[model samples]
Target: MRYVVGITMDKRGRDAVSLALTLAQSTLTSHPVELDLVHVIRGVPPEQAVSKPEREFQKLCLEEAQQWMAKTHDLIPKTIHSTTSVHFSDSMATGLIDKATERPCDLIVVGAASHGPLRRFTVGSVANALLHSSPVSVALAPSGYLPPSRLTRLTCALGMRPGAEVALNVATQSSVLHDVPLRLISLIAFDARSGAAETTDAASDHAKKLLVRASQSVDNATEVMVDVAHGRSIESAIDTLTWDEGEIVLIGSNRLARRQSIFLGTTANKMLRSLPVPMVVVPRFPAPESTADDDISI
Candidate 1:
């Protein structure tokens, strides 16, 4: 499956490119895989489609994106199919979804806007829109995150009691495309990193068993590992592992109610805020079946 990661000059997005590069390298380890990194600049709003400044800004955004791409020419691979385009749609999120569909990408990764605790729930109006609307799976990168690893070592937070098989499936599928191994990390018991080291060690042990169970259930074809980690927060335990320059933290989103608002999961949010590594947030489940032109047949 082709991996499509959406990136931009936005703080979090810029770092996500590093994360995307890590995933790209992993997938291409044996040979080569199709990797497309896209940047979508918002067009004029429908009501003001004719605004002169809007058009000018659009042009500037595209030009800047191209310039940035040129500067990073050395770091990015020549084998990977990389391209940039200007989308003339008023809605940024819509433009992104439209692009993903055109490319028929199997996975989509993007970043959450930089908003404070009070406003994070409503980040990137366009990004949030796509989350609830896109057809294929969508992943969100944490804000200002930079990975210390070159591979995608997933520390999935799925529980084993019930209603968590879906997460297991997500992790396994990711292992296939990422070509990076996945470790089924379950947060057994965590208080704070301030807690005793013994407590954290025990939690990591519990997660290992869950990973073993996951290993047995999924296709044992790929190189996957399972471990249980603990932290003052789930994020800290993940940090305990050694992350290379291109590593990433893939996470799942938490449900936000009507009045509760939309936001990244607790552990994910914390990780994003503190870590420099790139991370991806996989939604709880797949997008609805009915989609508009998600994959054009012809």
Candidate 2:
């Protein structure tokens, strides 16, 4: 039920915002829920800030947030509710994550500020900061992105540490809520340092046990499939497969740390950079007291 999105309060943020709500609606369509849209204004540097212009910009940003919230309420069907916020911070993504953690949303949606799908490189991987620090799932909407009229399924990136249980729980909820099928995949993992002994029958047997338990936990009535691809690296294996249209990928964040900041490590950063499709990075577990709507988590 908790969902958050980080947006830069600038001139170009309007479209990114529109896409954010629309993405939230599209994802939560079947379930019918509200979203908490957090906007952080990282004020201009002192040298760049003129008293009048800075004041004017702040005023305008507040006005836009007010109008945007009104527009969201007006445009989105009445079933869903929205709580809009505008705050000041020096760091956009990090500050938003702090607010989101306190509020404790199930997922986070971010709008891409960079490239297109056609480019050879990652057209937009700007959500890396949020993916690393967030205590919940993060969703990255593409630039000029539009949600499909109907959401068929959500794809998740499986990792070893996060385990399969949490991601499946959120996915199943979305599946049941939106009336869509669920696709569960265990991206075939290849450990470079893995020994030939580990790949033997015992390991496969143990893995089978985990996957079986994983499937049983989710109340997924949708079609499900397991894939095992062969590749030396994660990227190589990932590139070998094709991403389905309208698919929303779910990922999990690292465990909570004492210090808070945006951006993740190299592996996660690479994943975000290489994959052009939308991704949702979930926080590993519940967070500290300060980050939620009702101040519920202590």
Per TM-score, the best of the predicted structures is 2
How well is each residue in 86-196 modelled by candidate 1, as lDDT tens digits? 555657667767776785455566666766232122246656675556555555555554544556455456544443444566666666655566666555445544556
Model 1 error, position 74 (Å): 7.4
Tell me how far candidate 2 lies from the true structure as C-alpha RMSD in angstroms. Answer: 5.5
**lDDT (0 to 1) per candidate:** 0.55, 0.54
Per-residue lDDT of model 2, residues 6-56, tens digit only: 655432244355545545566443344456667776775334567977877
What C-alpha RMSD separates each model from the true structure? Answer: 6.8, 5.5
Q: lDDT of model 2 at residue 247?
A: 64
Q: What is the lDDT of residue 50 in candidate 2?
A: 71
Stretches of candidate 2 above 4 Å error? 8-31, 44-57, 60-75, 101-104, 116-126, 161-164, 188-207, 254-265, 288-298
